[model samples]
Target chain A: MSLLSVRDLTVKFSNRGQSVTALNGISFDIARGERVGVVGESGAGKSITGFAMMNLLSRPGYIDGGQVLFEGKDVLKMSAREQRSLRGNRMAMIFQDPMVTLNPVLTIGQQMVETLRAHRKLSHEEARQIATVKLKEVYIPSPEARLDQYPHELSGGMRQRIVIAMALLLDPQLIIADEPTTALDVTIQADIMELLLEMCRSNMVGLMLITHDLGVVSQVTERTLVMYAGRIIEAGKTRSIINDPQHPYTQGLINALPQQTPPGSRLKQIPGSMPSLNAMPSGCPFHPRCPLANDLCRTTMPKVVQYADVEVACHEVQRLQSDLTSEAAQ
Target chain B: MLQYTFRRTIAVLPTILCLIVICFFLMRLAPGGPFTSERPLPPAIMANVLERYGLDQPLYVQLFTYLKNIFFNFDFGPSFAQRDRDVNDIIAAGFPVTLTYGFWSAVFVLVLGIPLGVIAALRQNSFWDYVMTGFAIFSQIFPNFVLAPLMVLTFTLALGLLPGGGWNGGQWEYVVMPAVALGTSYLANVARITRSSLLEVLGSPYIRTARAKGLPERTIMIRHALKPTLLPVISYMSPVFVYMITGSVFIDVFFSTGGIGQSFIDAAYTRDYSVILGLAILYSVLTFVLNLAVDLAYAAIDPKVRSGLK
Candidate 1:
């Protein structure tokens, strides 16, 4: 059984005078110790999915229909007190901007110890000891001295590391990292991602990484979910999606990745911008941007179906697959 | 800290010197001699009066002598309006009364303003928020002179629970009207600043991070929100404090309290240059000092400032 299952989650936002749909019947699952990569462009409802799972969605935005089952318990049904207990203890979240994630006035150690004391009843001395251990886990040097230094004094990479350290301290079963490494330098990004992957591997922690970077999804995630217009258009094992993309949107995303074959080669990009949540295209949301779009694609939303361990939603995938096989034979 | 104090002190020297020079010259320039009372005095008697205060000397010589006495000896030459009474002694007697009243009002505004603002911001469109905001606006929009009399009429005339004006009955009760009159305006200012700053700080990402950490609502407010909100409030409150210390002439006059404010109004009416200039110099100096203290406070609250100091 999956450790966490989200069944037909749909989130809608009321804007101006209309009920705008942000997430449309998206569903997925995470097995124990699984690393799932949720890839989408900005406003693709990837972050919304993460927030919904945590029950942290902001105002004017509500989960109209969804069941977020964590360990077979419905998160939406949990009391505020129960949710509070689960938030910092059973699941922790690390945000994108490290500078803002940490309070400017508080010392790194103070913030860490407070997090510790919030979920677990411990003496100040015990909390400090745990904080020092977590700081060391994230490879911060001089853990004792760094504890007293405020957020302003720390470097960006160091602060991000400290945030990761705080998340791992409670040994949470699941961690929702929403583009946590996007703000870091390219060089530092690899290191932080490696650190997160290693920690999750060792601790048996399930990670839900939300990002638009396909390369990162390939490197760290075992499973990848391609979301478009607030819906998951394609999802499968990482290798299968990258090597043999079934959905037209997934193929476009992979093709759009910068090529290594030639320096001056023209880069391929998706034709149109992601549609606004205010007014999404009917039938299939990606149909307007799909090259393979036809009359049938415009009139009907495709159903998600399983084929060879991959779940794809497209009417023409079967025809395209056979045509591509014949071309490969030639 | 030393550099801050030295810079502030150096900047104030000119203002102090200008007060001394202008007060000395303008006092001499006032119409009629000091002895020119309703009952006219003879020339021989007036000459002795001028000589006794050293007004008989050359203009420049008299200025130099008075400057030396005030700046070096800390002497505020005897009051010409009231014989045998030293100017310094009169200021000393009156300054404390004004200071006490102003200090109490400052404390009252801070105590009341902060929580009211925090609650209003948290509640936004709620009932108490509207009530407090409306009350604060009404008190501030209505002039203190008008508000003071209304308060006296309500509490003294209608209620018959407290005295109307004077610092009579009890010390605490004496403070009630002046403090309320003074604090009503300042409290409104504090509330407005706090409300705006609180809203901005509440929207900051760190506040969300604070909430995500599962901190209780009250803990999040006092620890994470209040500190940054107070930064702007402190900067605004400093100037208000200085104004209160200098005294609001209308409130003093309406109440008939013999405080420095009343003395200032009397001096300005008669164009008593010594008293006017003395008060001006003291007011300017106090304002300058408070502004410096506010700067230090800014540095203390923000770490960027502390490192910038070095």
Candidate 2:
């Protein structure tokens, strides 16, 4: 069985009079030790998926239907007390905006020690020692000095490292990092991703890397799931999805990437923005922007089609050979 | 830090100078001079009295002399009409009483207000929050006069539990009813501010981060949220403290307490120019100091603020 299996997860938010669906029955699984990247445009329910899995959805937004099974135990079915017990111990998650993630008034040492003490039965000194090791593991130089400093005393990158260190101290089974390095610069981004990947590799921990940057995802994640307008448009091994994208949305996302090959060549651009969830398209959400959209594509939603190891949700992909022929002709 | 403090202190100089100039002229413009009365004194006696107080000179000269005595000699002239005690002495005698009432009442408001607010915020929409909200509104609506007498009547007249008036006995009970009467309005204001600010802080990501760390809700609240939550509260406190001082004037009359408030009321009623001007200066100085303290507090709460100060 997969280490974590998210089945038919649907999350909704009701504001004023309308119920807006943030996650529309999306399903995927991460096997033990798997580095899975969930790539999507902003507002594509990527972060909401992670939040739903952790049962951390804020009020006005809630999990309407979902089964987030971790190691064969369904997370959504668990009682609040049971969920609390599992949250910081067995499973952990990090968020974007590291500057705001760590409390300003607290010393890094106090926060980390408190974090460790909360989940485990340990003395202050014991928790401090473990937290120090965790800090060292995340490659923070002068871990001892850094611990004594408050979040405001540290730079943004340093604070992010400290936040990551706190998450790693418990040695959770699964680490869901939601745009962890988005607020960071490119250089710090690479360092943080490398540190996270290295830690996961060393400890054989399952990681769900949620981000919009496919380049970052490609560097660390082995498998990639592309979500658009609250649904998984495509899913496969990272290479297959990137190189052989069957869904038009996935294809557009890949083509949009600036290529290293043929320097000075013009870059590809996705024609339009993703649709709003409140006034979403009639059937296939991406049909409005899909280049090869037909009457049937605009009228009916496509189901996830299992082709070998990958899943593609596009009606045109049914006549695969003819589509390949047409592409070749083009 | 030194530069900021120095700048702030220098900034208040023009303000103080302007206040002095305006007040000097404004008081002179009022219907009665220091010597004015229903029965007119003989011109000779009036001139003698004016010469005695150094008011025989030109207005500007008199102002300059007054300024010199105020700034250099550190002398607050004698009461304009009372003629019994100097303005400085009255202030000296009254300030400690003001401090006693203001200090205890301030302590009461913060201690009562902040926790009540925090509880109300945490239990948001629950029974206790609702009750506290009702009490807070009631405190504001119910005048200190009504509340004071009502409290004195209920606690002292009816129950014989506490003292009804001014600090007579050196006991906590003597202070309680008066302090409560004086503090009720401020307690309400502080509680309201605390509730709103805490609500905002509770929604911030750092608090959520603490919760995600699985820290107990109480620990998350008291440790993680409370301090930053207090930043706004502390900034607000200075003005509230000033308001408490100003508000105390009314409470003093109602409760028959001999504090700075009562003296201010008396000074205002009698149009004791020197005493009024002295009180004005005292109020200005206290306000400036309180504002400076608030800025220092802001620096501590937000490191960015301190760094920006550099």
Candidate 3:
């Protein structure tokens, strides 16, 4: 059974009486110990999906309609007490921008110990022990001293590691990391990503890694869901999605990777930026940026369908799959 | 941290000295001598009084004498308007009443204001949020002077639940109305700061992390949100603390609480130099010390500030 199953998750943001859908019936699952990455541009609702799954969407954003089943329990239907117990205990989240993700006033030790104590029947000392162990797992030196320090005292990379340690403190079944390394230095990004991957693997914990970096997604996630606007456009095994992208958006994202361009040449990019959520394109959210978009694509929204080794939502899936095969032969 | 606090404290002496000199000279600069009675004293008696207090001396000499007496002798001399009373003793007598209401006012602000603010932030845009915001604005607009009278009318004349005026020597019953009157503005300021800052902090990424941890909403708020929210509110309270300790003229007159403000202002009207100078020094010193205490508190609450202090 999947550790976390999200079905038809719809999120809406209501501002001054007008409601706009941020996540339009997006759905996916994470098996026990599996790593799934949700990739998209800034406004693609990647983070919204993560927040909605935890039932933690801030106002203006809410779970308009969705079923987030965690360990066979419907998260959206759970009572506040039940939801609180499920959070931080069975499913923890590591946030982006570690610099601001830890409380400025709290010592690292206090932050870690409190989270542990919140969900368990442990004294301060015992929680501190667990926190220290988690800190050591994240390769933090002088783990005891680090706990006494504040977020500001640590470098961005170190703060991120602390945040990762806090997420792993409770030995949760799944960890939802929303762009955990996005605010980090490029050099430190790989290190943080590697640490997160190792910890999750060793703990047998499932991970939903949400990020815009396809390179990191390919390296870390076993399965990948490519999000655009508020819907998943392509999802499959990470290897197949990278080797054979079916959706035009996924192809554009992959082609736009720095490595995809020849040395010293301009990087390939999707021609248009993501449409505003308030004014999403009619047929497909990605249609404006898709080269293969046609009148049918403009008039009809493509639903996710099984196509060549991937689940894709695009009118040109068949054409793209055939083109990929011929290109491979050449 | 201790060394930083000590250094800051030592650095205040020159400023205090400068403050005292300017205030002393400024008071002298104002018209009317301490002995300026409506019906003038006989010339011999006036000369005798001026000579006795050394008011007949040069301005610079009188300034030096006043500074030396305050710093070295620890004397505020005697009140010229009330011949029998010493300025220091008179001030000491008035302090307890002011401090009592000030203490209660602080308690009121913290206990009620902070939670109102937290609720407003947690329930952003809800009915409670609107109510709190409106209440804060109302409290801010009606300064204690205005609020004090309305409170007297409500609690004393209208409802008759408590006394209309008078401290009754710091009795709890008398303390209630005054505390509310004095606290309303302060409470509003605190609530506003807490609401805005906490609202900002709630939207911060760390708060989302706290929520994601599955900690109860209450736990997240008290543990993760309150401290950062307090940083700005604490700063706002520093000067207000000095004001409360010194007392307000409106509070003093309306409540009939014989506090330092009433004494100082009365001294100003009569040109009672010793009483005026005594209260001025007390205020300046209190203001400086309270500000230092706030800085020290900043270090204790925020580790970032603690590190900076180091």
Candidate 4:
């Protein structure tokens, strides 16, 4: 069984008396030690999925319908105490913008030990000992000294490392990192990503990586889900999805990478911007920006249909798969 | 921190000296002497009074002597407005009254305002939040002049829950109305500041991270959000704090509390130079000391500002 299973999860926002779908029946799963990436543009609800999984969605954005099963128990049905126990103990989250992720007023040691003591009945001295070990595991220099220092005393990269260390402090089975390296310098991004991936692998931890950077996704994720609007447009093995994207929107995202274009030339971009959530386009949410969008695509929301290695929700991809099968038989 | 406080303290001496020179010369510049009255005094009586107080000397000589008396003899001279009473005598009697109300009002404002702010922030658009916001705005609009009397009428005459006026030698019961009246402004200010400040900090990514850490909402608020929320609130406090501690003329006069604030106002009306100058020195000194304390507080709260403070 999968370590985390999100079954037909739906999130909605009721703004000014009208309810808009933010995450529309999105379903996916992560087995133990698996690494999955969810990618999309700014308003694509990528972070919402991560937040919903933890039941930490801010007000107005709520779980309209969903079953977030953690180790076979539905997290949505758990009591507040039960959920609290599960979060940061069985599962943890690492947020973007390390510069602001840790409490400015708290010392590194205080933040770390509180998290440890939250889930387990540990002495302050015991928690401190565990925190030192986690910090050392993340390659922090002089872990003991670092504990006494405040968040502002550290650099952005070091702060991120500390955040990652905090996530791993309680030996959680799953770690959800939302654009963890996006706020760091370009030179530092690769180092942080590598450290995170290495830590996850060595700890045998399931990782849910959410970001818009396809290049980073390809490097760290084994499986990838491409989201458009609030639904998953396409999902498959990261390698196949990056090399030969099935959905029209996925193709645009993968092709739009700078490396996909020759140097010094304008990079390819999807024609229209994402539709506003309240004013979402009818049928397939990606149909407006989809190059192969048709009357069927505009009229009916595509269902997730499976191919041999991919599960995609696009009418064109569905037709193309049939045509390829027929041509192969002939 | 020690070095920063020391350097900041040294910086205040010149500022206080500058205030003294400007006030000393400006008070003399006004077309009134310490002996000025609507009904002119007999020429002989005025001359005798002027010479008695050494006001008959050259303006510069009088200023030098005033400075020398203040710095060397620690004498603030006798009050020209009040007969036979010196400036020092007034301060000695009034300062303690101000201190009593000042300490209590501060305690009242902080105790009531901070928690109210945190509750409002936590319940952003709830009914209670709206009520607090409304009350904060209402308090801000009503100055102590208006508030002090209403409180007297309601708490004294109408409800009869407490005394109307009089310090009664700094008794708690007598102090309540004045402190509450004086604190109304600060209470409102602190609530609004804390509400907005905590909301901003709550929206910050750090607070979100704390939430993500599986901390209970209470823990997240008290531990992670409180200190940063307090930073701006603390900054707003420095000047207001010194003034409150020294005294507010309204509180002193309305409550019939003998305080330096009331003395300063009376001396200004009567052109009591020694009294005015002495109070000015006290205010400037208090302002400088409180500001330095605020900087040190910033250092204690955020190590990032510690180096900048020094």
Candidate 5:
């Protein structure tokens, strides 16, 4: 069974008498030891998906309809008590801003120990030992000393490592990391990502990495979900998707990468921003900016079409695939 | 940390000196004397009294003399309005009662206000949140003067469960009405601050991390949200705390508590230079000390501040 199967998940917000659908019935699953990256621009509901899956969406934003099945158990159907236990014990999450991810007033040991003791009946000493081990697992040097220090005492990279250590304290089955190293230095970012990937691999923990960095996603995640305007526009093996993106939006994101352009040349950028949820265009969300948009694309949402390894939701991609097949036959 | 404390302590002196100078000059400038009674004493007696207390000296001389007495002997001289009683004796007699009232009021503010604030924030737009918000607004609108009499009427005259006035020989019942009246506004202020501050902190990424860690709501609130919420509340409470301890004069008068607040008002009205000056100095010192305590508390509670100290 998949470690986490988020099926037909929908999240909505009611802001000032208007309803906004933040996550529009998106569905995906992660198996044991699987690493999947969900990449999207800001406001594409990438973080909301992580929050929604955890049942941690704050007010004005809530799970409108969904099935978040962890180990084949519906998370949304669990009682508050059950949900509490399922969290940290079965599933953990890492956040974007490392500096603010850990409680400022609490020592690293206190935070880690508290997380351990929350789901399990462990003594302080036992929890501390476990925390120390976890910290070492994250490659934090002299992990024993780090436990006593507060989040503010550590550098951003160290703090993110501490956060990761806390996430691993309970030996959770699945860890959802949302832009975990977005706030760190470039060098530290790479190091943290490697550490995270290594830890997850060794522990056989499934990872749901939510980020907008296509490069990081390609490097760390085995499978990738490219989201646009709250919908997953494309999904496939990360390498294949990065190498040959089918959806125009996914293509736009890949082409806009700085490495794709030569030295000193302007980077390619997608035309227009992600549409605001309230003003989302009819049918296909990305059709407004798609170079190959047609009348069918403008008014009707395209169904997901499988092309080789990729599952892309775009009429143009489907037409192109069929045209290529017909031409090859001729 | 010790060096910061020492530096803070040394910083108090100039502030106290400045307060003394300002209060001394302002009091002398006011058109009244302690001896200006309806039934005035003979001119000779008045002159003798002024000369004896060294009040007849030039303003500079009197200022210097007052400073010398305070610095060297810690003398606040005799009250000019109430013959034979020194400012020290008056404060000593009244301050304990004021302290008791202030202490209990602070307890009430914290014990009642903080949790209520936390609940209100957690509930956000719930019925309880609206009710607490209304209560906060109501309490703020009704100051100590207005609230004190209303409390006395309700609890004293209407309920008849507690005494209307006086310290009642330092009994617990006597403290309830006065403390509540004195603390109501402060409670409202603190609750409002805590609610807003906690609401802000609840939205912080750390709070989300706590929730993601699977911490129960209570643990998340107390462990992750409470400390940062308190930073703003502590700074806001410091002055209000000193105000409570020095006594809300109207509260003292209405409740007949005979606390330092009443004495302060009486001293001001009669222009009792020594008593007024003494109270001013006391208040100044309290303000400095309370503010220092707040700073220290901030450093202790907030790791960022603690690291900055290092």
Candidate 6:
């Protein structure tokens, strides 16, 4: 069974007397030990998906309709206590900014021990030992000394390592990291991502990484989902999607990468910004900026269709594929 | 930490000196003397009285002598208006009452105000939040002078559940009316501050991480949210606490509580130089000390401040 299966998940917010749909119906699944990367531009509801899956959306925002089935049990149907137990223990989350993830007033050890004791009945010593071990696992030197230090005492890279250690304390089956290294320097980001990937691989823990950096995703994730305007526009094996993008939007994202342009040449970019949720366009959300948009694309949302190993949601892709097949037959 | 404390302690000396000079000069600047009575005394008798207290000396001599006496013996001198009583004796007798009243009121402010604020912030736009917001606004609008009488009328006359006014040897019943009267505005201030600060903290990324950690709501609030929320509240409450202790003159008069607050007002009205100067110096010292304590508490609770000190 898949470790997490999020099907037809929709999240909405009643912001300022107007209903805003932040995440339209989207479906995906992660099996044990699988690593999936969710890549999108800002405001594409990437972080909201992580929060909604954990049932952590607060105020104004609500899970309008969805099924988040974890281990064959619907999360929406779970009692508060059950959800609490499943959280931190079975599924954990790492955040973007390390400085903000750890409580400022709490010592490193205290925070880690608190997480452990919350889900299990463990003595302070036992929890502290586990915390120290996890800190060592994240390659923190003098882990024992670090337990007594506060978040502000650590460097940015060290703080992120401490956050990762806290997330692993309970040995969660699935970890949802939302832009976990976005706040760090480039060198630190590489080390942190490598450490995370190695840790997940050794423990066979499933990871759902949400990021805007295509480079980071290509290195760490097996499968990739490209989101646009609150919907999944394309998804496939990371290698296939990166190498052979079917949807025009996905193609635009890959082309816009810095490496795709020659030196001294201006980089390519999508024509328009993502639409505001309150004033979203009809039909395909990406049609306004899509180079291949047609009449059907502007009038109706396209259904997802399989293109080889990839699933793409664009009418132009279907036409191109058929045209290529007919030309090959001739 | 030790160096910080020592530096802070040394910093109080110049503050106290400045306070002493200002209070002494200001008290002398006022229009009347301590012995100004309905009928003027004979010149001979006044001369004798002035000589008895060394008031006949030059202003600089008197000021220097007063400073010398306090520095060497810690004496605040005898009350010029009250017979056979010293400033120290009056403060010793009266300050305890004020402290008790202030302490109890602070208890009310913390016990009632903080939880109310936390709940209001957590609930946000709910009915309970609306009710608490209304209560906070109402309390702030009506100052203690206005609230005290209203409380007395209701609790003392209408319900007749408690005494209207009296110290009553620090009985719990006597304390209830005065504490509530003194604490209402402070409670309102604290609640409003807590609610706003906590609301901001609740939106922080750490709070979101806490929620994601699967910890219970109570744990997330107390463990993750409350400390940062209190950073601003602590700084705000320090001055409020000193104000409660030293600025309760109206409450003291209304409740007939024999606290130093009443003595302060009486000394001010009577133009008793020694008593007024002594109390002013005491309040200045208290304010400095309380502010230092708040800073130390801030450093202890916030890692950023603590590390900055190092």
TM-score each candidate.
Answer: 0.89, 0.84, 0.92, 0.96, 0.93, 0.95
lDDT agreement with native, every candidate: 0.83, 0.84, 0.87, 0.90, 0.89, 0.90
Best TM-score among the predictions, by candidate number: 4
Q: Which of 1 and 3 is ahead in DockQ?
A: 3
Error of 6 at A125 (Å): 1.9
Docking class of 2: medium
TM-score for candidate 3, please give it. Answer: 0.92
Q: How close is chain B to the truth by TM-score, in each candidate?
A: 0.90, 0.91, 0.95, 0.94, 0.94, 0.96
Question: DockQ of every model listed?
Answer: 0.53, 0.51, 0.79, 0.80, 0.84, 0.77
- DockQ, 0 to 1 scale, candidate 4: 0.80
Per-residue alpha-carbon lDDT of candidate 1 for residues A285-322, written as tens digits (9 for 90 to 100): 88999999998889889888775558988878755656
Question: Global lDDT for candidate 6?
Answer: 0.90
Which ranges in model 5 have alpha carbons more than 4 Å from their true place? A16-18, A324-330, B1-7, B36-47, B56-61, B153-163
Off by over 4 Å in 1: A15-18, A260-266, A307-309, A318-330, B1-49, B56-64, B296-300
Candidate 1 lDDT at A321 equals 57
Q: Which ranges of candidate 2 are over 4 A from the true structure?
A: A16-18, A260-267, A319-330, B1-32, B51-77, B104-108, B123-188, B246-248, B252-258, B265-271, B292-310
lDDT of 6 at A296: 95
TM-score of 1: 0.89
Q: Residue pairs in steric clash, candidate 3?
A: A88-B213, A109-A147
* Candidate 3 lDDT by residue in tens digits, A1-330: 788889999999998899998999988989999999999899999988988888988787888887999977899999998999888889999888888888888889988988888899999999999999989989999999998888888899999999999988888999999999989899999999999999989999999999999889999999999998899989999999999988888888889999999999999988979888789888977777778779988888887778888999887885666687899999
* Native-referenced DockQ of model 5: 0.84
Please write out the lDDT profile of model 2 over residues A55-128, one tens digit for every residue.
88877898989799999999999987788877777788888999888888878999899888887899998988
What C-alpha lDDT does candidate 1 achieve relative to the native structure?
Answer: 0.83
Evaluate fnat for each of the predicted models and list the values in order.
0.39, 0.58, 0.89, 0.82, 0.93, 0.79
- Chain A: TM-score in each candidate? 0.95, 0.94, 0.95, 0.98, 0.97, 0.97
